[model samples]
Target: MRQNLNYSYPQIFWVEGRPNLGTSCPSAPPIAPFPPPVPDRRRKPKNHTERRSVGLLVTSLLILLALTGVGLSMFRIFHLEKELAELRESASTERIPPALEKLIGQKEQSMKKEARKAAHLTGNPSQRDLPLEWEPTSGHAFTSGIQYCDHGLVINETGFYFVYSNVLFRGSVCSNQVLTHVVYKKNPTLPGSHVLMEDKGINYCMSQKTWARKSYLGALFKLRKMDSLHVNVSKIALVNFEESKTFFGLFKL
Candidate 1:
């Protein structure tokens, strides 16, 4: 026996220092060394067309916006040009011939002269406990369809009317008297005047001092043609006939 033995293959087992080369483990395959692990320098998109598509979409949007803005600008310019043309035409046609201008001026003057007046009655005359009379030409007195005739308003047309009246009662000395104000409607058809509204004032003022009080009445009534309306007071001597404080009016609805 040899003191030492040498074999090409690795010995698997030994018995009493003798080498047994019948079975041996196979050597692992050699792994090639990775080339130092190169750091990635070039960038890449996961999808090949991703970056290109995004850039193209941005460029397309910009182009579309430019086109839309250009279209809107052109449209606005066209609309403004059309309006300018219309204005120019209107300006050109605004002038009238001299004869037509005179006629129009005369027509305007006539219309102004014939302007409708309101039915605002504010005027004079009444005795104590008597029907009041009004002056038609003074203190905002005007008549349109309602005629102020002989202390009464005569309706020219049949329709509903709003009648209003105000009476101011005052005295130098307070006299606790019952002051009555009444508005009546009369016509040839009725025997007596029909009372439309009335107001009574009792103990209205302080006992010793001079006092003033107002009675205002307004109402809507269905009146007929030629219906007459009048205002009456119980004590006319105590009435303050200030135009601003006392007025009667009827307006056709």
Candidate 2:
């Protein structure tokens, strides 16, 4: 007898007297590889905005600090300027006391009066009279209370006057002789000149070559207005013209 086989259905086979089934089926479609993870675009925008806000905050803080510093400096400058202006205003409005002003005026007047009553004169090298003519030292000679005329100092005020004179005598040969210096005063009431003070130097230097002597006279006397005062030396030729060596002066007490 011939055997029949079927291909469209499952086939069964017997082994050791047990049945086993075999089946043929199409494979499932190949599974696609998992797709790459996508980035979270919303989260990225939020993070960027946060960073920008932080930057802006920092910039604002820095700007505020700068502006504060500038404002403080300007305030300090303005304060200093205001203080300076106040000081200037106070100085401009300040005034000296009246008592101080009066004292200053009195002092000035006293100084002027003192200046007017003093005189200093130097010897004249060309004088030939008994009463020596003196040349008043320009810077050192000043007389407001008296007039200097010819060889005489004419007093214009009456007071106790302190008179002084110095005569320096120098020669190639020492004279052991006496050297005399005198201060004399004359007035309308007196017929002639009266000696106020006299100085005599006897044997002032030893007899030798290049000898020098100085005669000085100083005294205080009551003087009348219009009194004329003069200086005299024993030998006019021996009198030194140097201001320091020979001088005459007077002051009122």
Candidate 3:
């Protein structure tokens, strides 16, 4: 059975002004905050006169350096020139003097005289200052040591010489060898340079036959001219104008 409703229900009306508490619409998107403003930087002020003055100062420094280098170079050049001039002057003043030249000449003469005397002592005593007769001035018997036989006086030392009594042979033949000697002659006006020997006669050989006979064999050397005489050596015969021979010998006084 339907019983009449006696209880009263609470009424809910939909109003536009207020929303329901349980249900909610999407919240409006949160707004982004504005960015902070950047501050302007301050620049230093320029001075035109100061920039020009600094440029001038740097240029002046460079110019001063160049000038200093040039001054040093000039000083060095002047110094070198002065030194060269002094050297030239010194050389001119130190040249040999005339009086000194005379003294040198005298000394040279003295040396020559001594040398001639020495040459006389060695052997090949020149006949110019020697006696013709055999006198034992050299303390050695001329005949005892005489190894060569010749036609003329063989000067061995200044005062001593060998004079052969007779000539055996004065001719030349073919020889594979030869001997040489220096003959000294007086260089008149030149002190101590006097001497002469067979060497002075070498160019006189007209033919090979003459050379073998006239060639200055070792034994034929004058005592004083022995120094000038070279021994029997190889190739001497080659230069020799003489024809080839097996053996050759020279005898002296």
Candidate 4:
């Protein structure tokens, strides 16, 4: 026998002898619709404006820290400068000692006196007297610290002086006798001329004919203002009148 079957309903399957419903291998079971997807509850995505605002806040904080550091450095520098200026001002106010100031003034006065007094006088050959007086040469006399008057040098300041003189004596014949040289000073306090230095030369020449001799006298003496000095020799005619050969000079020491 032949039979027509319909499969419109798949839940039921007909076997060779009986119709089966809910068979394990005849058809698949119905599938329930998928449940809605669960929402992500732990984290939320940030918007563009929120991200920009957070970055701006961080940038502002960093700028504020940098400016504070700069201000602190500048304040330290200014304080140090103020301290340095105060130190300088204090140093400027320090005082010098009175004794030192007086000493300095005295030294200045001494130097001024030294600058004002010096004299050098040369000799003239044509003069009289065995212990002859000397006149300053016409064009060769030097008077800076003192004055020259009539064959004498006058002091202008009271101080120690280095007095010096050079005399050249020559003759056609040698006497080899005693040659006397004297430097004398005349002052208001003394009655007559006082000798400051004296020298006597004996046997100074080895030759009997065409003999020549030279004498030099120099010494330090305390002289007063208004004192006058002169150079005197044993023989006037024997002395060389050459300005370079004979000279008398004194300087304040």
lDDT of each: 0.81, 0.81, 0.40, 0.81
Q: Write the per-residue lDDT of candidate 3 for residues 1-253, one digit (tens) a residue.
A: 9999889655544546654444445766878998887655575567899999999999999999999999999999999999888878868887546788789999988775444322111122222222111222243223322222221222234333322111112346544333343333232234553333333223434556743333342222234442221122222323322112212222332
TM-score of each: 0.54, 0.58, 0.28, 0.54
Q: What's the number of clashes in each of the models?
A: 0, 0, 33, 2
After superposition of all CA atoms, the RMSD between model 4 and the true structure is 11.7
User: lDDT by residue for model 1 over 18-61, one digit each (tens)?
Assistant: 65676655755879887887667696537858888999999999
lDDT of 3 at 82: 100
Tens-place lDDT per residue, model 4, 55-123, is 999999999999999999999999999988887886798644689779999998988777768877777
Which segments of candidate 2 are over 4 A away from where they belong? 1-103
Root-mean-square deviation per candidate: 10.6, 12.1, 16.3, 11.7
Any idea how many clashes model 1 has?
0
Residues 56-106 of candidate 2 have per-residue lDDT tens digits of 999999999999999999999999999888878867987446898799999
How well does model 4 score by local distance difference test? 0.81
lDDT of 3 at 167: 10
Name the best candidate (by TM-score). Answer: 2
- The local distance difference test score of model 2 is 0.81
Ten-residue stretch with the least lDDT total in model 4: 129-138
Better model by TM-score, 2 or 4?
2
